[model samples]
Target: MEDRKLTVRAVERALDILLCFTRGSELGLTEIASQIGLHKSTVHRLLTTLEEKGFLIRNPSTEKYRLGIRIWELSTHLPVFDESATLLLPAMERLRDRLGETVSLYLRDGFERVRIQAVQSEQAIRRVAQIGARLPLSVGASSKVLAAYAPPEVLRELLESAGWPDYVERSAYRQQLEDIIRIGYATSFEEREPGAAAVAVPVTGRSGNVVAALSLSGPVSRLSRETLVEYAAVLRETAEEMGLMLP
Candidate 1:
């Protein structure tokens, strides 16, 4: 019982320290201690712990603490139907309605992409992807969009694991990723499944990382080059709106 109390106290103190910088971009040790009402030594120790765990980073030049990338990275893994998804559903539905195509929300899962939410098209001959379906991040428009924004380490790991097409050269694939980043979206025609085409845009997080991909898919005949470009513009617009809603 005593040990549990101590653990709770430590957690509370750590959370307090984290909360101190919420109102500001960064905070010094003394400022954090004063705000959290903790001793300077205790605050320093907590800061060191958080820094070691990648939850905080100390600026060498300013000697102040700021939230770290790990926080944003972790935020990307929140539950599929969490607040971010809830906020995105209506927009996805709207897109599906507008284009009469299936729309999906895909999140990166290592060398794979998982469809977390989907709005299927009403057309009798429309493309459809199941929610909670895990697909390889090597072939689809959604895959390319996620891979284009994935960290270099992730891309290297995927390549090292033979997660790319044997026909495509590494340099060419890298160039494709660069083009996706530059053009703000990706498109695939019968890349994953025959007769299917998709256009996907990156859904960025507060830190500007591509946390998810919003895609619209349909029959190849319906998603021609001109139609694909038109759909990509709409998807990019919706994705931008969705990114603004992420934490």
Candidate 2:
């Protein structure tokens, strides 16, 4: 019982130290100790342990701690779908068949979006998206659809961190995000990659919160402006169907 209590307390302290860096990019030992109400020596020991374990890293120049790449590596292994993709795979396949384009399902992972599933187009001249690929939330139709419906706090964080295109004014981009939420879909024309176009719609969970994005993508030569709008309707319908079935 004593061992278990000690282990739990250590874990709690470690988590507290980690959480202290969330509001900012990096933090010093004294700042973490002050924020978590721990002694400076205790915080130093915990930070050293965490840094050795690859959960945190100390910048040589700043001499402050920040989250390490191990966090992202571990997060990529997390099960984003939880059997929800299995339920939606057939619908995605059907949508791909109907549109004759690549269909993909994307889920938000922290500030990024990951492609969890894909139904690739059979055509030789098609745009392909590999499964398990991570993309920035600021670009692409799938990412935009997920971002558009994200909670206010999450949306604000993404916008603040996102290096948006110079042509896209911050106020105008914010308005576009609002429009995407209002219209129930998003579109991208060679935005993330050249010669590619995509349209996407948000998949809601039982709580009515957006959980994923259903997207159709193809070569820009094939998926023109008119075609993207037409397929957007199909994507929205399929997303609604999946939303009803998600737990």
Top TM-score prediction, candidate number: 2
Q: Could you say which candidate leads in lDDT?
A: 1
- TM-score for each predicted model, relative to the true structure: 0.66, 0.67
Each model's lDDT comes to 0.87, 0.85
Score residue 144 of candidate 2 by CA lDDT: 77
TM value for model 1: 0.66
Query: How many steric overlaps are in each model, in order?
Result: 0, 0
lDDT of 1 by residue, 1-247 (tens): 9999988999999998876765577899989998988899988988999999999999999999998988779867776546667778999999998889999999999998988889999999998677767888878889989999888899989877855678657787778789998999898888888999999999987887878999999998889967988889898889888888887
> For each candidate, C-alpha RMSD in Å?
16.1, 9.6
lDDT per residue for candidate 2 within 42-122, as digits (tens), equals: 889999999999999999998899989888799677765886777789999998888899999999987789888899999
Badly placed stretches (over 4 Å) of model 1 are 1-78
Error of 1 at 36 (Å): 54
In terms of lDDT, the poorest run of 10 residues in model 1 is: 75-84
